[model samples]
Target: MSKRLANTLGIILALLWIFPVYWMVNTAFLPASQSRSTTPTFVPFGGDFSAFSRVLTPSFMNSLFLSLRVTLLVVVVALIFAFLAALAVSRFRFAGRKGFILTILIVQMIPAEALFISQYKMLQGWGLLNSVAGLSLLYVAAVLPFTVWMLRGFVDGIPADLEQAAMIDGCSRTSAFFRITFPLLAPGLVASGVYAFLQAWNEFTLATVIMNPSTKTLPLWLRGLAIQSNQATDWPGVMAGSVLVALPVIIFFMLVQGRMTSGLVSGAVKG
Candidate 1:
C-alpha cells in the first residue's frame, strides 16, 4: 500500500478503537435519562456529577482498596518469581530445562475454565477463599507463565559477555549481573509488571468464583451497581464506575510510560 494510504488507514483504525472509550466518558457525565436516550448526545454541555458522586460510597471504596491490594501483591510476587525463572531458563543449561519450558507452554495452552473447579477446591482446602492473599495466588499463577516467557526473551536478548566482562574486572558474578545486566532488564520488568497489574486488576471470572460478597473486588462491586434494583439497570452509575475503574490503569501507564520507553530503547541499544 502507498505510505499516505497506510497512514490514513492507521488513523482511521485508531479513531475506531478509541470511539468506545470516548462514548464511555461522555456517557459518564450525562444524567440517567440522557445516558439511555434513543438518540446519542455527542457532548455533555451541562453534565452533572451526581453519578460520579454516588459511586464514591463506602462499599465502593472498600472494594477499590481490595482490588488495589490484590493487584499490588500479584505484580510484586509474579515479577519476582518470573524474573528468576526467566533468568535461569535463559542463562543455564540444566536437566529438564526443556521440559520446564514446555510445561510453561502447555500450561498457557490449557483453558482457564478447565481448571476453575480444581482451583476453587484447592483454595478452599487451604482455607484461603475470599481473601486478598488467596486471590493474589490465583492471579500469580495465571500471569506467571506468560511473564516468564516474555522475560526469557529479554534475558536471551542480553549478551552474557557483558556480565563476564564485568566479572573479569574483579566483580563477583552476582555483582556483575546486578550492576551490568539488571539495569538493562528494567524495561522488560516494567512491561511484565504492567501485564500483571492489568490481569489482576480486571480479572472477573476467577474473582467471582473465589471471593464472597463481603470481599467483592471492584469488578464485582460494579456488577452490583447494575443489579441494584430489579426494576432497571443503572447505566449512568455503571458508566461512572467504569470510568473510575479505568482511571488507575490509565494513570499507571501515564506514570511509567517514559520509563518504559527509555527502558525499551536502552535494552535495544545494549542488546
Candidate 2:
C-alpha cells in the first residue's frame, strides 16, 4: 500500500513538473487573441502558426547560431579539461593535489554575480567582449569546476586494478587508460556535458553583461521578444520562441539518450 501510494505521489509530482512545459507548447500554438484569454486553452487544435513564423527572423537566427557556438564550445572544452583534471587527481599523486581539489571546491562556492565586475574587466582588457570566444571562456570557467568534481568521483569509483591488469597485459599506461578506463567514464562525461550545455545555453546575467547587442544569445533574444514593442507583450510569440529554443536541447538528448542510459546502468553496476 505504501509503495502504491509513493508511486501515485511520484506521478503527481512528475505531472506538476511537466505542466509548465505543456502550457508553453500549448500557448505557442495558440492564436494571439486566445493566448491572453482568462480561460486557458489546454489544447491547440487548428491553432495558427503565425507566432512561430514571426519568431524565425534574421535576428533570432543569428542569436540561435551564437548560442549554439558558445554552448558547444563550452561543453567540449569543459569536458576535456575536467576529464584530464579528474584523471590526474584520481590516478596520480602530485604536489599540491589536495590544494588543487580544495581550489575547485572554493571556486564553486563563490557566487557568480560577485565576479561579474572582474570578469567583465578581464574580457574587456582582452578585447573579447561581444565575441563567441569571450562568452565561451566565461562559460567554461563557470562549468569546469563542477564538471571536474563530478568526473573525479566517477574516476575514483573505477577500480585501479582494471587499469593495472590491462597494463600487465602488455598495454602502456596511457593506452590502458584510454582503452579501458576512459570508456567506463562515458556516463560521467555525458552527464557533465549536459550540465555545461544547459548552463551555457540558458545563462543570462553574464551573457547580457558580456555580449554586445548584435551578438545576443538565444536567452537574450527571447527577452527581447518579450519586450519588443511598447504595446502588450506577445505571449504567443514568446512561447513559440521558447519552444524553438528548447528544441535543440531536446534533439541533443535524443541523440545521446541511449548512450547515456547504458552508461548510467554500467556506472551503477561498477559502483
Candidate 3:
C-alpha cells in the first residue's frame, strides 16, 4: 500500500515538473489570437506553424550555429583536459598534488560574477570578444575545475587493483589503464560534458557582454524576443523561440541518456 502511494506521488511530481514544458510547447503552437486571449488554450487545437515560421530567421540560424560551435568546443576541450588532470591527480603522485586539488576546490568557491570584469578585460586585450573562440575559452575555464573534481571522484571510485591485475596479465601499463579503466569513466565524462554543454549553450550574461548581434548565441537571440522596437511583444513568437532554444539541449540529453544509463550500470558491475 505504501509503495503504491509512493509511486502515485512520484508520478504526480513528475507530471508537475513537466507541466511547464508542456505549456511551453502548447503555447508555441497556439495562434497569437488564442495565446493572448484571457481563456487559456490547454491544447493548441486550432494552432498552426505560424509561430515557428515567424521565429525562424537568419539571426536564428546564425545564433544556432554559433551556439553549437561554442558548446561543442567547450565540451570536447573541457572533457579532454579534465580527464587528463583527474587521472594524473588520482593515479600518479607528483609534487603539489595536494595543492593542485586545493586550488581546484578554491576556484569553485570563487563567485563567477566576481571575475566577469577581469574576464571581459582579458578577452578584450586578446581581441577575442564577439568571437566563438573567446566564448568557448571562457566556458571551458568555467567548466574545467568542477569537471576535474567530478572526474577525480569517478577515477578514485574505480579500484586501482583492477589496473594492476590487468598489468599482471601481460598488459602494458598504458594498455591496462585504457582497457581496464577508461571504459568505466564514460558516465562521468558524459555527465561532465552535459554540464559544460548547458553552461556554454544557455549562458546569457557572458554572451551579452562578449558578443554583438553578429555573433549572438541562441540565448541572446531569445533575449531579443522580449522587446521589439515600436512593436507589441509577440508572446507566441517568444514562446516559440524559447522552444527552439531549448530543443538542442533536449535533443542532446536524449542522445546521451542511453550512454549514461548503460555506462553507470556497466561501471557498477565492473567495480
Candidate 4:
C-alpha cells in the first residue's frame, strides 16, 4: 500500500477502536431516559452529573479500597518473586532449572476455572475467604507465572557481561548488579507491572468464585450496582460505573506510556 493509504487505514482503525470508549463516556453522563432511548445521542450535549453523583456511595469507596489493596499486593509480590526467579533461571545453572521453567509454562496452560474449587478449598482451609489477603494471593499466583516468563526474556536480553565488567573494576558482584544490570531492567519491571495491574484490576470471574458478597472488588461492585437497579436498569449509572472502573488503568497507562515502549534491550549493552 502507498504511504497515504497506510496512514488512512491506520486512522480508520484508530477511530474504530476508540468509538466504544467514546460511546461509554457519552452514555455515562446522559440522563436515564436519554441513555435508554431508541435514538442514540452521539454527543450528549445536555449531559447530567446525577449518575456520577449516585455512583460515589460508601460501598463504592469500600470496593475501591479493596481493589486497590489486591492490585498493590499483586504488583509488589509478583514482581519481587518473578524478578528473583527470572534472575536465577537466566543467570545460573542448576538441577531442575529446566523443570522449573517448564512448570511455569504448564501452569499458564491450565485453565483458571479448573483450579477454582481447589483454590477455594485451599483458601478456606487457611481461613482466608472474604479477606483481601486471600484474594491477593490468588491474583499473585495468577499473574506470577506470566510475570516470570516475561522477566526472564528481559533478563536474557541483558548481558551478564555488564555485571562482570563492573566487578572487574573492583565493584562487588552485588554492587555491580545494583549499579549496572538493575538500572537497565527498569523498562521490564514497568512492563511487567502494567500487565499484573490490568489482570488484578479487571478480574471478575475469579473474584466471583473466590470473593463473597461481603468482600467486593470494583468488578463485583459494578455488577451489584446493575443488579440493584431491578426493574429499570440504570444505563447511565452502569456506564458511569464502567468509566470509574477504567479510569485507573487509563491514568496508569498514560503515566508509564513512554517507558513501556522504550524496549527491554534499549539500555542494555550488546555484549
Question: What tens-digit string does per-residue lDDT give for candidate 1 at 30-92?
Answer: 888887777889888779998899789999999989998999999999999999999999999
lDDT of each: 0.86, 0.86, 0.83, 0.86
TM-scores across all candidates? 0.86, 0.85, 0.84, 0.87
Residues 126-163, candidate 2, lDDT per residue (tens digit)? 99999999889988988887778779888999999999
Query: What does the lDDT read for residue 39 in candidate 3?
Result: 80
Which residue pairs collide, candidate 1?
none
**What stretches of model 4 exceed 4 Å from their correct place?**
1-17, 253-271
Model 3 worst lDDT run, 10 consecutive residues: 262-271
User: Pick by TM-score: which candidate is best?
Assistant: 4
Candidate order by decreasing TM-score: 4, 1, 2, 3
Question: lDDT tens digits, residues 1-271, model 4?
Answer: 9999999999999999999999889999998888777789999889989899988889899999999989999999999999999999999999999999888877876777888899899989999988888889888888888788878888999999999999999999999999998999988898889878988999987899889897799999999988985778887888899999999889877876664455323331111
Instruction: Please give the distance, in angstroms, between residue 85's alpha carbon in candidate 4 and its true position after superposition.
Output: 0.3
Q: Give lDDT tens digits, candidate 3, residues 1-271.
A: 6999999999999999999999989999988888777789898898898999999988889888888899999999999999999999998999999999888877766666778888899999999988899988887887788778778888999999999999898999899988989898887788878867877888888788888776789888888876665257777888899998888789877866764565445331111
Q: List pairs with backbone clashes in candidate 2.
A: none
Error of 1 at 165 (Å): 0.8
